[model samples]
Target: MALAFGLAWVLFSIWMSLPWLTDLGNLAHPLIALFVLTFIAYVPGFMNAFLLISLVLRPSSRRETPAQWPSITILIAAYQEEKLIGETLRSIAALEYPGKLEILVLDDGSRDGTAARTRDCQALFSALPNMELKLVREEHNRGKARVLNHGLELASHELIITIDADTRLEKGCITSLVEHLVASPPETVAIAGAVLVANHDESWITRVQQWDYFHGIAAVKRMQGMYYGTLVAQGAFSIYRKQAVIDAGGWPDTVGEDIVLTWSLLRQGLIVRHAEDAIAWTHAPETFTGLAKQRKRWARGMIEALAIHKPLLSMRKMRTMFIWWNLLFVSIDLTFTFAFLPGLVLAFLGIFWLAGPITLLVLPLAALWNLVIYRIQTRMLKRMGVKMEKSLSGFLLYAFIYPLLMQPVSVWGYFAELFGGKKQWN
Candidate 1:
């Protein structure tokens, strides 16, 4: 961490000394130029540089397996997931685990046939002597956090895992999660798994999202895990020590329940790690509206976490830096949406003010960051026997256009949370 910090500062020093940046500062209001340069360029560049250095310097080590795997309860949170619930259940049924497993489908008052379909799949998939499948029905529409708390009460084992109803696990995913969780340091109470896009071929939106998941989200989690605190034990697929979660007050009722829960655990100084080999494939939203809604919910969730866990800002730990890093995302998103984007339009119309040649200096770092992360993630996928999707168009859109759409949407979400927008679970 010290090395990474030094490396980041060194790069920042070089970036600050650029003559064009000085000129830009002179050309505009110094504060405005600093805002654009600091949030828009330096913070992101520093983070990427830190992640790259840490990954290269302290790569993940291979661990030996435990003598015996612990029994675990798997919770599937469902809400109008009739179409995808069966396949998800079957994937859990086919898991390659040695320990006794209990599968609970928490139906959160779905009007659809989710419960019936779970029952049908249960009959076919629960024949294994070591595993049992059951459905817990909530007649009223409670949110995911409440339903998960309900599942926690019925879990028979100390180890617990939460997976989304729309998520499908690879055959060895459970094994991988259990292995890593058991092998982690004693302070580690949770292990987040890798989630890939299953519907990347469905649309351009999904395609771009695939790259986002593969390059951005996964790489960030991997880096965070290296520091012994994976920020979000994402509900899509993650394992937890049951008592640890219970002590953390269970999942919170919020737009970003998972992130809040994770932060709660972190507040207690407990550690969380990420398991890249534990892979779960999920369906990305295929439409522009769907994508926007998802991103907005995510943005709102970050704000919720920041507001809820303000104490994290006072911690001096290496992992807490991620929380501080997230605080800057607000400014970064704001500048990109309101300043740099409009600057681009103006520059195209023959004005060079907010964004110009100086802005382009950040691109090489961004591109290199993407390349390094892609290589690391693809290597992990290959180790798991999954092939990388060959999509040039997806890469192009993700590299250029995806941010343009997402930053504005995230800004809208930030405002929505500030002004009391309605929250949805699905």
Candidate 2:
């Protein structure tokens, strides 16, 4: 599918560059330019669609050995999580893993009785046989990476599963994730669990974001896993092999430790797999300001990770193909950042100067393409048993407005990191 898309784009570009196409008129050049830009933007979408279709058609090849379940240490890094800490602990203790599982909650200098609440939860769980809950509190405020590493020092299991304090793992989530690692080769280092929006019913904003996760981010990840590997392992819920992480020098103290660690593991020749069956629910920001801050932090973290790992771009000894694939993904993000204004300008000019019928046809083509992708994505989510209350109209609003609104903020995040802004752990 990627090859077909590339071929189509190349042919389109060559045709547009032809002398006759350029000689058509001023209006013709803009139309040709629009065609070229549309093709370029469509590449990522095409690849994503291809991947999703492939994963859906493929047979399940997971192993069925209960004896192979490895002991897992669950790590939750908390900072002022007074309201959610108890619930997080309760959920971890309730997981149905067959093997031994230890729970560690690290408090990053929270003054709001977070440590006290964690200890109380630990005492509550102390009666459960074979389950150990430990609370490690720091006097000073260290970042999440450091707090996680501190918990790593006391881990008694080879498999370390990291969970955010605000996340709740579904029953049998651990078992589903561990099945993939045991079945795969020993080099499989990290496994990403599926995360659904816990607060989807909260507001319109969260509902839209939930759709984006299920249809956009989650769909792309499942597809990416089919070709080479999963690109980004979301931080909210992920499982990592302790040895692989330690060998990679532990998680980097960055805003996006999950992404950084994923890339680092890839560079070390370790496979990072995505376990779609391993489900967890997490809360999304309900307000626009909160959502913007979250996205900006994410964007800044991506830029910082790219800068620190720039050497991976030219390293031939590593997985060159995968590296190039990741670079292409990043290029798509950067292109989207700058593509909108120019696209709108050319589109308007084409409407005013060129045949009105031609412009009308082009606009609907883009919209229709987007709608088709959304329908496929929504169907996939429904098949996975996710409930959707909002109709197609809500999704349409997101498809048109959200991407354009996010562009300026993403661009701002890129420059902010370049000028030396620290990654806040709030």
Candidate 3:
């Protein structure tokens, strides 16, 4: 980690010393130039360089399977998910884990027949050996965090796994998570599973998100996990030490419950991991409005976590670097929205105010970084017996058009949380 950081700083220093960049600083107002060059070239450039170096230099470790599989309780928080709850339970039943397993469907007062569907599936899955399926119904709509806390209170095993109602685990998902978390040091308390878009074929929006998931999201998680503390052990599909979660005070009541909970664990000096092979398929939002809402909430969640876990910055741990690095994301997003996008439009209109020669210098590095991430992710998927489809359109959109929409929406989310916007759990 030190080597990676050192190399990144050296390269950044070299870039800053370039004559044309210095000339730009002299030509423009200091504040405007600093904002343009820092966010556009400096911060993101350093981050990408660090991630690339760390990834290329990451050491490989042999994965050892556990001799005995520990019992696990699966928690699914459902609200108006009648159409998907049955399939989600069926997917859990199909898992290859041999250990005693318990499944809890926490129905958070769904207006639909979610509970009925769960109960019907419960009867069908009852014949499975060494498995118990139960439904816990709430009379009124409690949010996801509270529902998961209730499930935590009733969880029957030491290991707890949380999956969203729209999530479907691969056959080997549970085994992979168990193997990774158990092989980790005793302090390792949670492992986030790799989540991919299941409905990429539904629309162009989902298709672009598929690339985001398969490439960008996976790369970020792998980079963070390399240092032994993944920031967000996503509730979409993750495994946690039940006792560790209890020690962390269960999930917090926030839009980004998963983010806050994971940060809380980190704040307590516990290690969280990511299992790249533990794959889960989740439904992505098919419409633009849905995607914006989802990304906004995610952005808001990051802000909330950072605000709540401010003391984590003072922690003397290797993973604490990631906590500090997260502070740059909102600034990067804001600059991209308020500065870069408009500059892009101006450049196309034959004005080179913000999007000129210096800005274009970042593209080659960005392309190389994406290429590296894509190859690594594809190799991972290939090993899992998953085939990549040839989707030129999706890749192009994800590369060029996705950011134009994503950054602005994320800025909205940051401001929304700052101003106490209405919090709704989709």
Cα lDDT tens digits for candidate 2, 82-181: 8888887888778777788888888898999788888888766677776888888899999999999988888999889999999988877888788877
**Candidate with better TM-score, 2 vs 3:** 3
After superposition, the stretches of candidate 3 with alpha carbons farther than 4 Å from their true spots are 1-28, 388-390
Candidate 2, residue 357: how far the Cα is off, in Å: 9.6
In candidate 1, what are the lDDT values of residues 231-299, reduced to their tens digit?
Answer: 999999999999999999998899999999999999899999999889999998999999999999999
Error of 2 at 177 (Å): 0.5
User: Across residues 19-57, which tens digit of lDDT does each residue of candidate 3 receive?
Assistant: 645555777775677776678777776777777777777
Candidates in descending TM-score order: 1, 3, 2
Q: What is the lDDT of residue 16 in candidate 2?
A: 47
Query: In angstroms, how far off is 50's CA in candidate 2?
Result: 4.4
Which residue segments of model 1 deviate by more than 4 Å?
Answer: 1-28
**What's the residue-level lDDT of 419 in candidate 3?**
99
Name the lDDT value of residue 254 in candidate 2: 85
The list of candidate 2 runs beyond 4 A from truth reads 9-61, 314-339, 345-394
